[model samples]
Target: MLVTIVSLWAQKLFRLDEPQPFGGAELQLTLLAKALVKRFGVEVQFITRGQGPFEIFEVDGIRVYKLAYRDFPPARTILGSWDLLRLLLSLKTDIYVQRGGGIETGIVGMASRMKNKPFLFMTSHSWDVDGTHEKNRGWIYGTLYMTGLRRAAGIVTQIQNQHDLLWHNYGRESLVLPSAHEIPAPIPIKKEGVMWVSRCETWKCPHVFLRLAEALPDLRFTMVCPQANSRELFLEISQKAAALNNVTFLPGIPFEETEPLFATHRLFINTSEKEGYPNTFVQAFKWGTPVVSLHVDPDAILSTRELGVCANGDETALRNAVKQMYCDEGWWKKYSENARSYANATHNVQVIVEKFYSLLQSLKK
Candidate 1:
């Protein structure tokens, strides 16, 4: 008698809240889901919270399990941790990946250990690791956040600096894995002016973009301020943009719908205080649009690689960069090509996804 051996494919589950409106974390999750399904034929599941009834839905070829809740508290809180613990216990997943750092991640880490499963942590922002954010400033919160990070089987950081910080502060090993970018097919259209897209958060500093618009009176500036957790900030930015003739403010649209805006934009502006490899940067690069950033430069690639302009948090430098890009067409084209080339070579979804797959496979051993 002849016997045949059977092989099994791995099932990966991601935990986050509301996969819609695609913020950085959500975009990563969505891109990972697509890559895993298309490339590796892995069974991917996303667990999220929603206002609707508890249901499983398919969005863009991924299984999304939305837990019905009136309002989901931050996972670091007592109630939030308890809810996360209960939910995590109910599911049997081969590997659990969490994108944000908080009490919820700690609770999930604990649950993974108890269930004999591997938990992979992805640092979403600088505040997630540096302990500078308000949530991680206090000793109690810092301890709690670190507890989960420490429990993770492996940690993924977006930049080398973050990896070094993790090792120095938490004594944990991490892999520097930048977020993946899906290069959109080029559209044959005339792209013009400058575009800035972000949530209306104080830390994101939309006021800086508005000031840039003020400085460049002749250039058209389009601002997309998505309403997230801060309604007041959204209104403030909206009212301010209304006063400027060169500035136009748009309410948030679905993340899938923003490709055209990026494709047609001459440049992308980022005014965030800090980031863990911003999705916007990659998005801009994929569309052959250069980026003019205030502070974020993952690996100093902006300045060193000439992907775009990095102001190093200098207002004057940032203003000059924008003006230079606007006025000099040939210079702008060079940087734009550089942006696309760098993104295609380094942050392509296929390349990053393979890295992620290898990392997850290593955890199984």
Candidate 2:
């Protein structure tokens, strides 16, 4: 049976969230796809709504069809399907695989019915993803999230924490496919000072780190953020951090450049409002970099150990956490070790991939 991954974000040029040469969803897909192809000899194809152009490429020896898509309003997230329908019919896919969570699930399921294909919808959340911010987007949008979720042939959640929510609200019937990331071998690299890595969006709370920089003048502060139109806000942050002689700014480097950065950075900070098992935190663990992040529920691995000080938007607490992390010295190492060990055991790619392989095999039977 051929596996067709239908996604809206898969693109040709590589967007900000695209798998860096190092790792991300694309890397995860690549690893599993290569293994599936080599071991099972199953055919794997990808259908994406990438806007640029339509073409094909060999990613990790797997075939990807970069189908072009035009922009649509929110309705498509739930009911609309243009190329997605076309790809499904053309390939007569046996199993449809979509990443964690997205409103596109319903439309894909609809198309699958038309083409007689069953899909595994991977729901990456406990209740709602992270902040559940989509609820505030609009009434119809919120309803679509649930509508798209409930009608899937099968559901797959990254963590067991989310199983009850899907089972109760969406009628569960999903396998628990825990999240995973490749454990990059330890890289001997040098990074100096405190570092924060993530999209430079408002949700990441870059301003909070600016406050930390102000509080700790002696320690070095570095932020690696995507270069986007948020220049005005970034400039404002840079100025605020400037007061601390140790603070510096670096452009958003590609994932390939991140190993050395993660290796060298003494500390890692996660300032996001929400996430479904962050790629950055896994990188931090692999690199032995500890993080101080705002509270996010899906990261149960970090939350259980309390290895990460989950902040609830408390600036004073943020200040104190920074002090404890840097000023105490030994505290940082302990937390870093904790984060690394947890990731090594719990979220290792091989183990997680085995879980996925089991689910696929079960679906076949």
Candidate 3:
């Protein structure tokens, strides 16, 4: 049986150009698509935003078709629906999958219904399942996203909270699928410092991390903050980090190159106001680096499983957690071992991909 999966990922995320944007949702899409191809022999394709009217290429055995979503400015309005509809119908695939909450969600959902194909919508943020994401994006975009949400044949969320909220808000049932990852072989690391990796967005609170570094001047810290929303904000945060003698700041690092940092770090810190199971958390766990987070804790696994510490929005607690984890060798090793074991048992890419394949196959029936 041959199965084809088409994804509607953003071009900036899928492309390999210089200064390419790095996003957790996009990276998961890429990893899932590649695994589907390599492991299950699934034919994968992507329809993404592009500068040209049409551009075709391939990445890791998956085919990509670019559409000029940006060229048609009116497409931002309902008037541009037919152009996107046309592009999706042209794919002729078995099913469509997309992540995140945006106007594109509605576009993909509408196209799938028109062609009588199953469309799976995956939520990437807590806001994605809750009503806030829709309300923040405004009327037209939000309306389109709701349309896609309603029309989806299936929906997947990163955590149980999202699943419960999706049902409560929209009366939609979804599977709680943990984010997937390919585990690397265990390596010995010196594990000397704390590390933070995230796009420099206001909501992520990169500035809060700088404050943490300043407060704990005795400890070494590494901040890998790439430019997300504002270039000026990135520079501002970079300068603040540079002034801290204990902090080493890098504006960006490729997604493929981040594992070494995770492997070498004793602690991984997350300062985001909220999130849908951060990929960095999983990466840190895979590399046996304990996490100490300020706000977000997915599934409450950090506390229950002893994988890491969730500060529950306390800046002081967050700092203390980091300092304690970095200094107490025996405590750190216990959490590190638990983290690695938990990651392998729950997030192994091969097992998750098999689950997706089974779900996709059932949808076909």
Candidate 4:
């Protein structure tokens, strides 16, 4: 029997095709979908949010269905939910997969049960599995998400931290998987400048990075933050970065355009308070560039493998670590080589997709 997997997420179909708003989970999903179709011949599809009414289109090998409806206030919420349910049931795939925590989790779960299909929940952030989402996202969002999470046939976590949290908090067992990435051939490029890339959200602490840039006036800094949650906040951060001569602020760039930045940047910095194995980290590592993170370590692989430095939530320490990575060539080269080796060994898309395929096949039995 042929296995068809549907990825349910409200995002663009592909990374390079659109300069739109998307996160690490969407990027990982796109990579996994492409690899599954190319290497294993499994049929893959996507249900995303777009500008128009319900429509279907094909990009690469995946068929994408767009759901464009507002979930505003009293009555439209019900209409929106009904429309989403109709779309989910219409797909009728072998398995339905959703990443991150949202009301769609419950919606997809209901559709899967109605269709007798297995639903897979992929954890995309630490908050999704750590029992904090209930308090963070409020009770209603949590209730709907938990309903779906409990109904999931299988769960996949990007790190052991999420797996442990899932088990401890909810008594759910999950397979630990790394975020998938396409491992590009090694290209020699002159690496310079420090780069920080993420959505301009409050929790991301983009302000801290500005301070780091101010502290180290000699080294050039690049910020590729896209607007997230608030556009006014994005403009605010952009203006702040513009005030500093050493810092260059970009609203955003295409996903394909970022790899060259990663390859040529001397350091990749992450200021997020928490994450689920950031795709940017994998990108930097794959490009043989060292990372300096403010908080997240994701399985402590950064320190364990000497791939990068984790400041452990201290701003001064983060600044110092970036300075050290930039100034010390021997230290920087060592981390860069280790990062590339670890990323290629663990996150190769073909290998990761094979593991995902095996899991999906087992579910069929």
lDDT per residue as tens, model 1, 222-302: 998877676787788899999999988887766665778888889899999988788888888888889999998877889
Better of 1 and 4 by TM-score: 4
Off by over 4 Å in 4: 1-10, 13-20, 69-78
How far residue 328's Cα lies from its native spot in candidate 1, in Å, is 0.7
Candidate 3: residue pairs that collide: none
Candidate 2 global CA lDDT score? 0.65
Candidate 4 lands at a TM-score of: 0.94
TM-score of each: 0.89, 0.82, 0.93, 0.94
Identify the runs in model 2 with alpha carbons over 4 angstroms from their true place: 12-31, 38-40, 69-80, 125-135, 139-144, 187-191, 227-245, 297-300
Q: Which stretches of candidate 3 lie over 4 Å from their true place?
A: 1-14, 18-20, 50-53, 68-83
lDDT, model 2, position 151: 51
Give the clashing residue pairs of candidate 1, or none.
Answer: 75-104, 76-103
Which model scores highest in TM-score?
4
Per-residue C-alpha lDDT of model 3 across residues 1-365, encoded as one tens digit per residue: 23334344356656645353557787788788888999988988876655555678887888877665443456534444655677787767788888888777888888888888888888999988879756887888788889999888899999998899899999999988888999988656677788999999998999889999999989999999988768899889999998999999988867777888998888999999999999999999999999999998898999999999999999999988988888899999999999999999999999999988887887763
TM-score comparison, 3 vs 4, better candidate: 4
Q: Is candidate 1 or candidate 2 better by lDDT?
A: 1
The 0-to-1 C-alpha lDDT of every candidate, in the order given, reads: 0.76, 0.65, 0.83, 0.83
Residue range with the least summed lDDT across 10 consecutive positions in model 1: 1-10
Q: Any idea what lDDT model 3 has?
A: 0.83
Ten contiguous residues minimizing lDDT sum, candidate 3 = 1-10
